[model samples]
Target: MVTSEKNIQMIMELADAFGPSGFEDDVLTVARKWAEGLGTIEEDHMRNLYIHRKENTGNKPVIMLDAHSDEVGFMIHSIKPNGTLRFVTLGRFANIAMSSADVLVRNALGEYIPGVIAAKPVHFMSESERAKGGVPEISSMVIDIGATSAEEAVNRFHIRIGEPGVPATKCRYDAENDVMFGKGFDCRIGCAAVIETLRRLEGMDLPCDVIGVLSSQEEVGERGCKVSVKHANPSIAFVFEGCPADDTFTEPYAIQTALKKGPMLRFMDVSVICSPRYQRYVLDLASEKGIAAQASVREGGGNNGAIINTALDGTPVVVAGVPTRYIHSMNCITSGYDFEETVKLAVATVTSMTPEQIAKF
Candidate 1:
């Protein structure tokens, strides 16, 4: 069994990898390496990694733990006449958070070119313009690469249309306070939980087959899970994710979720209504095991949507997520305690289920 420190190191490695929506190859490499010697691993055409372990062969319902490998990023659209690059967002991005942010532009040769999201200078802008609310439109945004002309910029850096650009940052751990700060924690944390669980379950005597899916294109709309669900055909599934915490000094009701509260057991989401029976089962398991957990009612967003109705012909689906702050932004934060709880909850929930128990749902 891997230690908590090793699991945390794996998560940090994943968070540092550059695997935006359509470019998940690098992240997959790391996942594949960690999944070795644990189970049967495969990568689909869509770049989704599926790791399966055949423990009990009694026709038990398959259980899948899903997490997306992609993060919010951008794609280059055009090179401007003045050497600045015009780019379009690949996934959801908070435009207000894009200003003055450093970004990494991945060229065709797999090199990282450093650039910063350019914004209009306050000195040149009128007070009225500065007072305008909300983020500026994409048309008004450009990436500054320190080039004086388009020719020089293109020659020095292979900036082309459709290349992926990600936030240029590294995962940082605060040893004194035991906090980790990083980008892409939204789903990376979830991915880490899935992988850690798989590693933990290695060689254990279990009653059912378990599948670990590092899904793709989730930030684009859970498209990768749609494919994997169909292929694995799991009877019961858990979609692990990181939910945005509403803790910016907001009102109580406005603060939808919070960190360090264990996994949030989502009852309903925008895409999928979790099976009542499975929700109860998960809650009961957490209670029985004395695991830290929180109940959530999400109106929108969760991967349960794709898993519940997509493949396996209406299988029971449950969502377990860690509360994250500033989701989809460059500085998403999550508690290490919450992350570890998510892993424990998933392992316990899956280990406790029997074929009959799963099929009843």
Candidate 2:
């Protein structure tokens, strides 16, 4: 088992890496380095990394644990006639929070340039405009890189259309409350869980080969998972992810799930409906083991449910997620306790699967 301190360090490191949709190379590099001494690691054509452990006889069907390596970010659409830069959203983002926020712009050569979202001062707005409230539209936002003119901006930064911009910051811990806040925890936490679980299972001689996929392009769609599943051809799969929840202000009992309670066993979502039998099996295991868990019926589509359910003509799929608060923003928060417990649950589920159990499904 990975020590608590080691797990925390992994989470922080994964969260600190920069990986927006279609630009996951940096994060993938870090993951590859971490998997070097662990086991045999392979990267598919889609750039999804599959880390595995040697299989044992009498093992169940191949089980895959999928986690996305992408996060929400922006792409430079054009360099304006002036020195300002105009960009479009690469993923879902709130314009209100984006305006005037510090951002990191990556050029074609992978250079990090500091910039900020520039907006009209509130004092210059009319009272009626102020009454209407909210920041201006995304199209009105401009990226300021401290250049004087268009010529000077082009000369110094070489800013071009289609560059990627991400939030500029690092993950930090709230020592007083033990809360860790940073960007990309939405699914990087999931990636860290899969990596750590495989590390924990080292030399266990487990049945059936287990594939850990650090999937890409999940924010735009489950594009990477579709290709990875076709290649792995696993008969059963589990997707490790972080689910959005607001339990601190909302009543925990009334809410769908709460942080630090353990993994949330999702029953259904828009992308894919979980297999009833597999869902029951996971829940039963959690109950028998007295592992903290909850059920979630998310309103929107998410996780690897879309591809995993349809892989290999049909694969039984389950999604285990850590409850994350304030997802898709500059700072997403989750519980360290839930993260550790989710890893435990995934390792147990994979190890407990048997050939008979898979065939019965």
* Candidate 2, run of 10 with poorest lDDT: 52-61
Q: On residues 202-257, what C-alpha lDDT tens digit does candidate 2 reach at each position?
A: 77776577888899888888888888898777888888887786587876566776
Q: Can you write out model 1's per-residue Cα lDDT over 1-361, one digit (the tens) per residue?
A: 2226777788888888899998999999988777777777899999888988745353757788888899989988888889999888877887787988889998767799999999787777877777885347766899888877888777878677889988987988764554678888878888888888887787787777888888898888777877888877787888888777766766877555677768888788777788889888998889898888888787767674455455667888888888888877777777788888889999998888787887787
Candidate 1, poorest ten consecutive residues by summed lDDT: 302-311
Q: List the residue pairs that clash in candidate 2.
A: none
lDDT of every predicted structure (CA atoms): 0.81, 0.80
Model 1: lDDT of residue 200: 75
Best by TM-score: 1
State TM-scores per candidate. Answer: 0.94, 0.93
